[model samples]
Target: MNYRSSELLEKAKYYCNELSKHHILSKYWYELALVLKGSTARGNSDQYSDIDLVFFCDKNILDRIVKDYYDEGLISREDGIFLPLPEWIGHYNLESYDDLIGYFKEKNYPQIWEYTNIIILHDELNRFSGIVEEYNNYVFQDMITDIKEKYLSLQLTLDWLRHPLKRGDELSVILHCSKIIRLICQLSYLIDEKTYPHDKWLFYYLKQTEFGNRNENKIKELGKNIINNSIPLQVDKELDEYSQYVLAESIITDLKNQIQLKYGNEPWLDEWYSFV
Candidate 1:
């Protein structure tokens, strides 16, 4: 049950070798590709961690391989479809390397991390590695810009929702508090120059970083309280008769100031204040 990265890589290799035993797969062995993703690739894997792999091949070939395994009882139908390949990919056609890159780029940060952190088991032309290199070298200015915009927009929404929250609208209170927690987590990752994973993995990813480690327990508690429709003690103490939304706003502002102090001002900061 303990899933080490080396063991996971070996398992992937074994699967590739098994697939290669088939005449059709053997003929296209070089074209068959495997990538180790998720917690294992990040080196934060645990006993319960799921092994996520990305298999790149023609759709028909993938289908045949999966079906063969299923028919032979080597893998359960669910295991053949879901464990090796997630159910989400069923909706998309990802046969080409270009298509894979496009999917990775367009998907959320976790998926991008998966693409960037892959260990290609077999790539004849070395296409997969080249694509990963391109992504790694690409400028992140646009991504930063997008995050800044989202932060500002959420701030504005929180500002607008403050009145309803104070008016004792339960839904507004929950939504407002939730947005603050999310904004802070996103800003923390952005300031650290790390890609923020999806929301479910946000705190887990945060715990793995130095920045998050300092406030890991605090953030975890705050996140739980937010989900349970309660305000964290720290936020309540800082409220000072102001609504919870204001506390959230001030936290984000303080974070912005800290980032500015550490990294100095950029055009984005100027633009952010211009809107404020």
Candidate 2:
């Protein structure tokens, strides 16, 4: 963690502790989970980074707590983001996840994805931890129980690879390789049941997953070769785009087989009709 992140974390911890001690919340304190999220939780904080906190608890309790936070000026203003808090500032969002589950009876991927990237400062009731592990075994279709759409995407993108390589179309070859690699990367996160944060961090954190860790070197090599295709169309006599086809082919092939071996391939076939 960088200096600003470390310092922000400390201040956040203190603020939460204070909130717990206040007369308004002391009794219900244990029920609350003070979740540190966003850029700070990702440990890439700068002075300008706004600290976001998620409050997970019962609706009544959360309502009370949010009102208190606002009254103390401990919560932020809607006017604009607080500039680098050289001093203590309140958490910007009174984000509540469980309260959503209570109202809606389910959680969505966007919510799940946010919860996945968190620094849980406090979860005395032990609710947030269980929610985090809601993802397991295989990725859900939009976090639904039955969806194998990710693999279908992987297979389709994989199929496109052969044509470009056969035709020796340099641009098409590069485009297909890029898409295949991205699909594989997406599937890696789905298999591991983690959120693909979808930015520079997409690949950075992919290597942290069970699938990505095991195939780290291969993924890195493939990524490097594909990305080395220079922009503005530099022709390299030395480089052959077909070289990547074998590597990508191997990756998708292995992933496809393993997923079928473990989960069986019926979900996509059964549910795909609805999609079409």
Candidate 3:
């Protein structure tokens, strides 16, 4: 842990310790497990970032605490301390190990990634620690299949949009550009073996990674221009008379080539262009 992480962890520890003293939480205090998650645990947090914590305890106890404490706003901003209160507080049941296993089996990689990336603050019986271990050990072959399907679907959509774009449909052209941005971001995460962060952190994560950092500005500018229903002048100049869209098709095609070169060709790629 770096200085920031250590600082965040200390704050979380203090908050959890105070929270454990609540009448509703006191009974399960010793048994409860605490974990630091999100950007803080991932070591990517900054001054503007907020800490996220998860507490694992009995389902019944958690339910009661949710009703009597969290729902009641007992843990609120009224208390001023070194750290802002947890941005998110998640409660998992220690007894319901099956749910965690089910998330992994169902290829819910985001949730699994959340658990695996956590920093354990407390785990009296090692229940939460064991779940983290399980997440780390789980195979993700199914996740790769899901990503490939998404890539293929987006590729097909881009192909279909070409006709409308050639007919001077601005909406179709914009949609095409937007989907290209999405596909590139998705492919970057797939190649990195990382879960795609939620939209709030999507661009941040993209620019922070090695592969994405190179095209980060291009992706952002192109995506913004597309959303605004316009194409970049440079991109428009690159579009050949035979091409359907005002924006350069080579942008997306080049990204596809990079994915193929880096990860090797997928069988779906051949099928993807077959319909085009």
Candidate 4:
């Protein structure tokens, strides 16, 4: 659980900066870049939003330094709750800029966005200032990959729904609907060209999208009809299932069109079929 803090963010930066100056704790670490990330850097700190310090040093040594600060009564190891003036520090580290870029290649675009959204607590030489375009290219490619994977998954789920729909198995159909809804949310993030602000904040972000803004009511109505069978008995059950079936098919058709329109020129990653 993240606790909301009005003033804790600034305080965490000041103290950590001072700590990095100390030789006993910082050692050779001060030569590397120190970044403040996560909620605090993003300006959305709650009580549990521990100061996420990404130290660009040896990963093993980063843990030891965080432990050293914990021993000094400057920062707490646990969530900064119940303690007075707690700078709950959570630490992550990368060895160098190359190591950081390696992380970009491995993560989802949304997560890669999080890594790039950082506050430089200590970087005397400004080593990280030039990574903006490099990261942006990585994010764009990652999103394309994510969209392709989602398109494939959506196709599979639509195919899976056929059995449940034919059997009039309401429970199985609703369960499949839930899975599709999750995919829709994920796909919407890519289509809308918005970084996923994480699941807890999904609804907050979703409403801001043009697609979600317009279709919110229909999505909710369809959700209720599928999940709870809330429509009156006068509403035919078979008709309801058929409606869901059409919606799934429509989603697939629409998403394929969106993909082609947005990324038609992107070279295929690999050719699965050829006249050999």
Candidate 5:
């Protein structure tokens, strides 16, 4: 962690002590409070950042804590406000693992792992670790595959849009590119669910996840180039028309190789390419 991050965590510690002074939710002083998102941010100073703290506790204690904080007007949309997890989601039952799982499943949420895999604060025994582990094992594979399939389909669509006859088709291709970028960020969060910088998390997480691969440098270049140069095109410009096709082609090709290594190829690999 950087110096700014360390200082932010220290500030969070001070916040916890302040809460303990209230006595209304003092029982949670002993609760686990693991900090996250030290490296997955863009800002250089603590003045621009909010320290993320995930506190795991009993349901009753959590309820009392939320009530006390809200009563104190600590939770708000403005900066430096302390938001209880339930208020952030606009739902209140997160203390129950079953309820949280069911809610995410029902919403078809992509960041289930994020909400479930909170960093514990004070519990030395690491009781909440198993919650994250269970979802990673059971939910991760399907989410990865779903994202892969969506990218593949978008690739085929973009490839088709490359034909001269499909002038207006480029608009749809751009929409699909937006979806692909959003999905990539969401999947990367599941792959690296430690924290949230909101904007910078996806880029940092993707880079970290791809760091050990031989193709990491190439993948980084492609992603950065697409975002920097290709994303701001006008609807009818030639740059906008061709950029999606090429960008989608590059992303699909790189992801195919990665997926093949991670998930292996099937007998119908060539046929699947044609189908895509």
Candidate 6:
């Protein structure tokens, strides 16, 4: 690992240790911390940026433990149910390795690995590894195959929106643009080991990825125009259609190349978007 990764690992280790002190999670359940999205690849993980954590436990025992902690005042509740552990804590969830991976696969949950540093507790390491292996063999392999198809379908969507007839309607453009952003965001996590940020940081982190570049500027311009227009035009005739086309094409091409490189072409590639 480079210096930044090494530092990140250490910080993650420190966090695990602190959680252990609180009896929230210990080194035994600590699996590994993963880097998701952002400039972490650029070595820019700082205090303002939160590090996401996935705390795995035996499904049967996990809920009991969390409940016990809350009852004892060792933890506090947010939103009446969600436990707010500490300031630095980003995402916290409990799942047995088996069910958790299944949920991940089913939901197309991105960033479960990215910027995630898991600390598997000692006794459960074997269980954790076994589940991961099973997922790799079954769920993950299928997921890789799905990634390519989704990318191809995504490209088709962008291609359709690029047609002259479809290009002029601002509402239509916004709809297609939103779909493209979502596809790229989801696909980025699927391939590059990325994750969508928590709701609080979603837009900011989106702007930090390739998907952001494709849609953020236009979304911002449209947003401002909408706010300023007393009666918003059904379509913004003033918007730069040519620039939008170029941006959309670049994003589609980048996504296609990334999909091919990460997941070889699969015959079922286009079918994957049915889930979308």
Give lDDT per model, in order.
0.59, 0.63, 0.63, 0.61, 0.47, 0.52
Clash count for each candidate, listed in order shown: 0, 0, 0, 5, 7, 28
Candidate 1: deviation at residue 28, Å? 2.8
Best by TM-score: 3
User: Candidate 2 — worst ten consecutive residues by lDDT sum?
Assistant: 77-86
TM-score of each: 0.70, 0.57, 0.71, 0.65, 0.59, 0.53
Ranking by TM-score: 3, 1, 4, 5, 2, 6
**Given candidate 5, what's the lDDT at residue 127?**
47
Model 2 steric clash pairs: none
Candidate 5, TM-score vs. the true structure? 0.59
Better of 2 and 3 by TM-score: 3
lDDT (tens digit, per residue) of candidate 2 on 26-114: 87768777788877787888777767766677666667766665677765753222223235354534445554453223424345566
Query: How well does candidate 4 match the true structure in TM-score terms?
Result: 0.65
lDDT of 6: 0.52
lDDT of 6 by residue, 152-262 (tens): 667767666655323346666666666665666666655654455543445556655554556566544433432223543334343344455556566556666666666
TM-score of 6: 0.53
Q: Which ten residues in a row are the worst by lDDT in model 3?
A: 75-84
| Model 1 local distance difference test score | 0.59
Per-residue lDDT of 65-86 in model 3, one digit per residue for the tens?
A: 5556545665443222122354
RMSD (CA, angstroms), candidate 6: 7.3
Tens digit of per-residue lDDT, candidate 5, span 96-127: 34544453454334345345433343444444
Please report, as a residue range, the 10-residue window in candidate 1 with the lowest summed lDDT.
85-94
Q: Can you write out model 4's per-residue Cα lDDT over 106-219, one digit (the tens) per residue?
A: 655565556666777777656555554466565655567777677667767767877777776777888887777667666777876666656655555567765567556655
Segments in model 6 whose C-alpha atoms lie over 4 Å from true places: 1-15, 21-44, 73-93, 104-112, 115-124, 140-156, 159-172, 184-241, 246-276
CA lDDT for candidate 2: 0.63
